[model samples]
Target: MSATVSREGNASVAGVNGPVLGDADFRFLREFVLQHCGIALSEQKRQLVQGRLLRRLRALNMKDFGSYCDLLRRDPDGEMGDLASAISTNVTSFFRESHHYDLLEKTLIPQWLAHKRRQGDRLRIWSAGCSTGEEPYALAMVLAEALEKHGAPFDAKILATDLSPQALQGAREGVYSLDKMDGISAERRRRWFLRGEGSYEGLACIHPRLRELVTIQPLNLLHDWPMAGLFDAIFCRNVVIYFDKPTKERLFSRYAKQLEPEGYLFLGHSESMHGLSDDFDLVGRTVYRKRAS
Candidate 1:
């Protein structure tokens, strides 16, 4: 719920003034985040919900959590998109959970290359919940070089999406602070990042060519996915952790449908194929392949 907490006491994203969650407040948080962003907060994790949403209350100028929830309900347009953006967890970077990328580069890409070697074409992967675009941009830069080495008669494109317009804007701009790329390889760093210059110096941006390979767009994962054709791979890592199990099952099933036969699915490291479906077969840590049926 949106609360106009007193802009009092210490202030931070995690800190806010609000009535602690009681039965009604817990229900409100669960319903609100779910309706807006498809996140299902659990009873055990009620405090986590309170902490994360408190910041939003402050931003919306709601005097308390009740008023915040009221605003979400009253806004027919469902300003929940903004709230959804805030609520959705997006802690990812270029080549996160390195082993996944390692497999993509070492094993999967080679397999795709072998199958497609006879035909000159383009490779397409969708990075759902692409956040600030680093993941796709890094993929583009790295994969391009890999393709060149393989002499595959093809290029690659990464479709990056997020539910947040703010995140999408950051992705489209392809800009980053230094910390965003610490995990990137030095060679990759040199090739993909352009050093900031002058007053804007110290910041870095994805090289324009790499930026061009990724098409950034705003997308609500809980809503219709606008593109067509199955992807060669889908990198929706770390995104489903906030969604409840039912939502994860449904979302992953949708992901299975959009993937090409044998296309890859990557999830957060802590996430598992457990209780999801037999539709995907786990091939590596958090890496999955669509089952043949």
Candidate 2:
């Protein structure tokens, strides 16, 4: 699976101090990213990609982009996460898009819980591209509160997944600095997070209850999914902005298949499904409901 890329074009340019991403390597990387992650890197993003991936190169102790491309060609799965992480922004916060959570908390969870009251019934939510845990923990807090409020014996769980190994580790740790707590309300802060004491001051740790509700794992959305059942709702906010149109269409189609009938799909504020998907109908701001088959 090794790709043959010419290394003779390597040189410093455009203030890229380290191994400049030569044209050949850049082309290979662009295709590699699009093929594996569904992120279309345009020519305009060349310098940015070069800048961001320099850190990856430094971390891997690699001298040039050609070798890096070779590594990816040889072992794509092993290095894909780091490569994706290097190129993509994982900036996220608790309740990053409050409106989506509002819809979930106020309407969806309650309705789903009511309907799934039987002994074997279950409620499931998937946080696709759940970077650094905030999204899923926020989801957990909402689900936890709803279950407590409903006072019902029911099974509920959230699946939080991402391609970045580093981000998944952070999500698993469930710890964050005080600054990252802005989007979380004071009441939720008091209820769902524990303040780190003494030497660990200024840090917030997620409540054990939230940890119990959320299961964090490594997943690449473009790859084969192992999930067997349909989800009541899925939060894929801010993750698809990097994808091209065809990628978005394919991803949305897969999402439709993964959702329960008339299930919800939440997207980032800046994203839209207009003309990209027919499986969903826009029901709210960046909120879509799976069409009945």
Candidate 3:
């Protein structure tokens, strides 16, 4: 038999049964999430949302989805971040997209270092939506290796930003299980990570030098960005696919403005900027270079 609500309005589907996330609740959450974080949710995602937020409902002792929505309206800070965290997909690994690193090492870094050497300048890279730190840390490793190979003392730093505080906390910790090192070479792993021992055996933490090269910050791309300087390259992979077309257009435009004239922008393998913005030209697979004007 289908679960029925008690007179007290306590959730009928609590525990193993799961909360009943109705159409109204799904609509409310969809609109709220899109308005706040620009993450558009389709009707098909109703089940997905219900599954992701069931724990939140149980955590708050909410009797119904309406109560959760009311809580959101009354105290957004109390639940919004958690909601974002629950909804965010943080699947990443060290050097998940090896080709991007190859481009950074073979072409982008070398050319930019040559120009910067002439100007006596430092390099800046932004890893927008850098969930759990892998992307930025990979960039750091590649940059460090390239600098060492070139025998140059060029200053460089990476700004890694994400909307989820939970993910940022993991990024800041810079620790991961040993199995997550599959993509990293033994030499690279030895150079960039410290093997954890004792109770922390089977884990690894990024070395001090690599950690120092990346700064993790909590940022919502839909909100105001306080960064002042332009970037030499911006890696915003796998991020905008969740946003609507208009949101994507505005963000791509903003990235163009924030990038140097010759700067590069990298997107996920499944994402493209073909109709989003004309300020950048497609130069490589899932990569764009800002037009020289």
Better of 1 and 3 by TM-score: 3
Per-residue lDDT tens digits for candidate 3, residues 67-95, read 88888888875566688888878788889
Which residue pairs overlap in candidate 3's backbone? none
Error (Å) of candidate 1 at residue 62 is 3.0
For residues 1-293, write the lDDT of model 1, one tens digit per residue: 33333333312222235555455655766776777577876787767766666777778776456666667678824565566666566666777788877887888777777777656645789988888787788678767777778873566678998877777788887778888878887888888778988865889877877866778878878878878878889988878877777888888899999998888898888778787887899888888999986
| TM-score of every model versus the real structure | 0.84, 0.94, 0.92
For residues 228-288, write the lDDT of model 2, one tens digit per residue: 9999999999999999999999999999999999999999999999999889999999999
The candidates, ranked best first by lDDT, are 2, 3, 1
User: What would the TM-score be for candidate 2 when compared with the true structure?
Assistant: 0.94
Alpha-carbon deviation at 69 in model 1, angstroms: 2.1
Candidate 1 colliding pairs: 1-69, 2-68, 2-69, 3-62, 3-64, 3-65, 4-62, 4-63, 4-64
RMSD of every candidate to native, in Å, equals 5.1, 3.5, 2.8
Predicted model with the maximum TM-score: 2
For the record, the alpha-carbon RMSD of candidate 3 to the native fold, in angstroms, is 2.8
By summed lDDT, the worst window of 10 consecutive residues in model 3 runs over: 6-15
Displacement of residue 235 (Cα, Å) in model 1 is 1.2
- The local distance difference test score of each candidate is 0.75, 0.90, 0.87
